[model samples]
Target: MKKVLIISSTRNSNLDLSKDIKNYLMDKDELETEVIALEDFELPLYTPTLEEQFKSTESFPKNISKIKDLICSSDVMIWCSPEYNGGISPIVTNTIAWISRATDDWKEGFKDKHCLICTSSGGNGKNFIKGFEMQLKYLGSNVFDRSLIKTKAKNIEEFEFTSVLTDFYKNIFSE
Candidate 1:
């Protein structure tokens, strides 16, 4: 079975969106899915000095290790996050920073992984999509060409949301 990890960057609307997406993904019997809220994890701010300290520490933090393991093992990741001031949320960025520093391969968790970006934002969310796409691509992930955007006046249609996921799933299996 394929291990699919669905991550939400916040506990608010983003989490709701993640859960909704998880349900749609679960409808695929062949996939093994797990959902996580980024706020639930204990992650420290990442820096070169922090990385040095962690590398020299006697033991790695359990929470970071656990989260890293999840990311490493997953075949696909669906990132559901909010856009904050025309960019990706800080929580998601923090998670990525910590994971990159903690992992031996640095980009192992994202390299070649299929990532589907979804957003529940108050704004247009186009900037978040563009920003995250660049970041994910830099991390070596195969980001989905299109993203699902949900906002105040407009919400993603059921068919459109599921169709995005369906196409992403097919893309993964095709590779």
Candidate 2:
């Protein structure tokens, strides 16, 4: 069975959208899926001082290591995040920063992993998509070019995105 991790960065109604996507992904019998919310991971703001301190401690916070291990173990990743201030949310970036530092090879958590990005945002969320894709590519992840976007006016079911998501997953797993 393929292990898939779905990460959601939103804390509001957008979280419902993430759950919906998770349900859809779980419907696939061959995939074992786990959903993680960024809010649940209490990552402190990253700074050079903290980085040095953490290195000296020689042990990362348990949540950081746990999330890093999940990323490392997953075959594919699906991200559902909201755009904030015309960019990716700070929570998402913070999680990435911590996970990158927690592991010896920063890219080890993402390299060669198939990724699918989706969003439910008040705004169009195009900037979030572009910004995250750039980061994922830099991390050497195989991010899908297509994505699902649901604006405030549409609900997940109304958006009718399951087919695209299914196809994306099928294509990636077939590789």
Candidate 3:
């Protein structure tokens, strides 16, 4: 079975949303799913100085190293975050920063992988999806076009959720 890593970028609605996604994917027999909430990790801000320090120590922070292992082992990645300041939240970006820098084993960890971007934010979450989709594609991920987005007044309709997940699942497994 292929492994899928679902990342929740915040402890707020995004976490709840990620859990929902995990529950949905867990039922699939062809795939195994795991959820990681950023709130559960003890990660420091990534910086050039931090990278140098980690290089000297020959190790990343415990949680970041663990996350790196998960990301490298997984066959697919699902990101659930809020739109912060018309872009992705700092937690998501920071986690990616750490993952990208804190590794030599999987330097291009995301290359040719499949990524699905979803958001449960107060706003429409369009900017986040757009920005994150571009970033993931730049990392060589094949991103799904149909995203799951939830606004204050509008929860994801069943049809939209079903359609997106169905297409996303097909896309990941077919690749």
Ranking by lDDT: 1, 3, 2
For model 2, residues 1-175, the per-residue Cα lDDT tens digits are 7888888886665667667777877778778888888898888898879889878987657888888899899988989899899999999899899888888899999999899888989877999999999999999999998888888886556445877787787777677
Q: Give the TM-scores of the predictions, in the order they appear.
A: 0.94, 0.93, 0.94
Write candidate 3's Cα lDDT for 1-175 as tens digits: 8889988988888888888888888887799999888878968988999889888988767888888888888889899998999998888888889888867733467888888999998889999999999999987888888899999879999888888888899888784
The C-alpha stretches of model 2 lying farther than 4 A from their native spots are 156-159
Q: Mind sharing the TM-score for model 2? A: 0.93
In terms of lDDT, the poorest run of 10 residues in model 3 is 102-111
- Listed per model in order, the count of residue pairs whose N, CA or C atoms clash below 3 Å is 0, 0, 0
lDDT of 1 by residue, 40-157 (tens): 9867776778767877885567888889999999999999888899998888898888888777788999999999999999976999999999999999999999898899789998
Q: Highest lDDT among the candidates is held by which one?
A: 1
